[model samples]
Target: MIRFYHAPGTRGIRPIWLCEELGIDYGVEMIEFTKEFRASPAWRKISPLGKVPVLVDTADDLLMYESCAMVQYLLDRYGNGQLQPQLGTPEHAIYQQWNWFAESTFARPLGEIVNHGREFPGENLIPAVVAEMQNRGEQCAIAVGEAIADKAFILGDNFSAADINLGYSIMLAERFLSNGLPESIKPYWQRLSSRPAFIRATR
Candidate 1:
């Protein structure tokens, strides 16, 4: 069995949604977001950083914590080419590009915004830093928005795991920034968010 350690509204949702879409049976251990949980010795072994998205595949005794890596693992092991392009293809290259773009290029700024805003709110909020992160996050959002705007999914006609990876970041940006998102991006999010798998995974 696969065990997904997750918290509501965390990046762990990405892999959880992928599991649902692929019809893979898995168990979720919902960890509450708190200092106590973050400091737990057992969780520390699973995720040295105490992140919510820790995947332990008891079947193989494999432990993974990175959200993007976990999503790719599930797809590679179970997708059977359903939502991914075959390796060595042009589409597969583009898929790889989007996966990296979603996490490193896009999720970085959004994460900064979330951390700063939450750790320092109201009068303590750093106007300049938040503004910078929001600006960067918005730019990344525009690129994603334009890419997925005319299509039903990220890779045009197919609903690929790239959408799952990118879609979760979009949700995070929307939750934190909540202002001046590219008008084009909002509808793309609506489309992804309404998916039964997305709904079920987050719930």
Candidate 2:
């Protein structure tokens, strides 16, 4: 069985949601979401940087730390041609683009906001820095809204893993952004959040 070392409300939701969508069996190993635990030698052995959502595929004796990579790995290895476009096609390129954008571009500022708050809390917190990150995150959200303006999903009518990828980042934006999600994104957020798989995985 595939074992997922996870903490609640982390990137682990991405792969766990994919597994739910694909009906794949996996085990969840909840870990303490604390700096001390993450910095421990034992957890470091499993995850070099001590990140949550570490995936251990016992069947292949494989261990993965990156959440998006874990999503792609499960899709390619066990998805059976679901939740993705044909490889090497333009559609797949767009899919990959959005997947990377979801994490790298969209999630970057939100993560910075979080890190800034954690590292510089109380009087040391910088309002301008948080505001700047919020602006960047809002820009990313607007870009997503524009991309899905006339479509049900990022790639026109199809609901691919890109949605799953973006969904988690959007969830973070909703939590972090001071102004909250734009009106353009509310419907899309509702559509993605209402999925049974999403509900199950997140719950």
Candidate 3:
């Protein structure tokens, strides 16, 4: 069995959702983000940076971090090709494209929005930063929207691991939609958020 170290309401939601989707018999070890929890020696051994979503592959004695990587790994190892595209194929190219975009373009700006919002709440500068972030987020959302517009999922008919990564990225950005998100981005978020996997992940 794999041991997943996670904190609720954090990025760990990505892998937790993947685990649930794959029907893997994984153990969830909840690690609160409180000062006391952060200082735990055991948790530190798993994640030196004290981040959530650290996956301990007990069989191989491998500890994996990063939500996207964990999701991809789970799909590759346990999904039995159900949620991954064939390598070097067009679908695989698109999978990598959107997955990288979600992590680099979407997740980064969205994180900046959250970080700056918390660091400078109610200040003029925070709003300005949020606006810039929202603009970047909107661009990424548009790209994702166009990709999934006519299809039911990001990979066009299948809910791939890329969807899990990008879907969560969209969800993170949606929390700040009231700040400066363009009207065009709403339906994209609605589509991603309405997925059964997304609903189960949040719960």
lDDT of 2 by residue, 88-112 (tens): 9999999999999999999999989
What residue runs in model 2 are displaced by over 4 Å at the alpha carbon? none
How well does candidate 2 match the true structure in TM-score terms?
A: 0.98
Ranking by TM-score: 2, 1, 3
Q: How many backbone clashes are present in model 3?
A: 0
Q: Which pairs of residues collide in candidate 2?
A: none
TM-score pick, better of 2 and 3: 2
Return the clash pairs for model 1, or none: none
TM-score of 1: 0.93
lDDT of 2: 0.94
Single out the weakest 10-residue window by summed lDDT for candidate 1: 173-182
lDDT of 2 at 71: 97
- Backbone collisions counted per model: 0, 0, 0
Error of 1 at 1 (Å): 0.6
